[model samples]
Target: MDFEKLIVWQRSKCLAVDVYRKFARCGDLGFKDQITRSALSVPSNIAEGMERYSDKEKVRFLWIAKASCGELRTQIIIAREIAYIAEPLAEKWITDTRELSKMLCGLINKISD
Candidate 1:
């Protein structure tokens, strides 16, 4: 599969945009930067990995992106606890991450298989 064409990449891009949009306008500079960085890492790693010449590299980058997703999950939990993010929005983001992570893993499996 073309990693660039993967739905997870598209969703991760959206997720990054959402993270930036939500936090960029906020007054908390620290949280905003951290969360946005983690979110941006997801798709950025995917794109970087796709530019590689090997499937192993692509999978490695996808795993890196997946790890970024985990970081994003943590940031979401913190943002929720501190009331930086609304519960509904946090829930939806977490749900999206969970689903996308699963699908990305599947895509990796398909590529390796």
Candidate 2:
């Protein structure tokens, strides 16, 4: 299966891009880097998993992607609290990460079974 064809992967990729663009001018380099890396990991892990030959490997990567979703969500919440992100945008991203995590879980279960 092509990871690009997966809705979760596609949405995650878009989210990462949005995060990068949104934080491009951020003054706090450490926070920006951490958040962006987590955001990027979602789709990256998904793609890596889908490209793997074994189900075990695929499930492992999906789990990593799900973990990244959680990490990204936490960062988004912190960003909003710190005023680095706007309320509306932070909420949207948080919602997106939740959905992506759920999607990754579903994929992992399906692949495992």
Candidate 3:
């Protein structure tokens, strides 16, 4: 399956773009780079997994993508706690990340079977 056709991938791509745009004005290079890279990893890993030749390989990459979602969520929460991100946007990002994580679980389960 084409990863682009997957809702999880599409949502993750949107999340990454939103994150990148939101942090564009930030002065903290370290935090910005970390969060943005994690955000981008979600969709990149998804696409790479889908393109893999074997289901096992795909599942491995999907697991990595799933972990990246948690990593991104943690960074986002930290950003909010530091007052770098406002409440509303952080909430939205958290929501999206949670949903994507669930979606990834579902996909992994199906692919594993």
1-113, model 1: which lDDT tens digit per residue? Answer: 56568788899999999998888788988888899999999999988887888889888988998889999999999999999999999999999888778977986787678
Tell how far residue 2 is off in model 2, in angstroms.
0.7
Put down candidate 3 lDDT per residue, 4-110, tens digits, no spaces: 89999999999999999999988999999999999999999999999999999999999999999999999999999999999999999999999999999999999
Q: Pick the candidate with the highest lDDT.
A: 3
Report the poorest 10 consecutive residues by lDDT, candidate 2.
100-109
TM-score for each prediction? 0.93, 0.99, 0.99
How does candidate 1 score on lDDT?
0.88
Clashing pairs in 2: none
lDDT of 3: 0.97
Give me the runs in candidate 3 sitting further than 4 Å from their true place: none
Give candidate 1 regions above 4 Å deviation: none
Give Cα distance to truth, residue 105, candidate 2, Å.
0.7
**Model 2 spans with C-alpha error above 4 angstroms:** none
Candidate 2 lDDT over 1-113, as tens digits, reads 98889999999999999999999999999999999999999999999999999999999999999999999999999999999999999999999999998999899899988
lDDT at 16 for candidate 2? 99
Give the whole-model CA lDDT for all candidates, comma-separated.
0.88, 0.95, 0.97
Compared with the true structure, model 3 gives a TM-score of 0.99
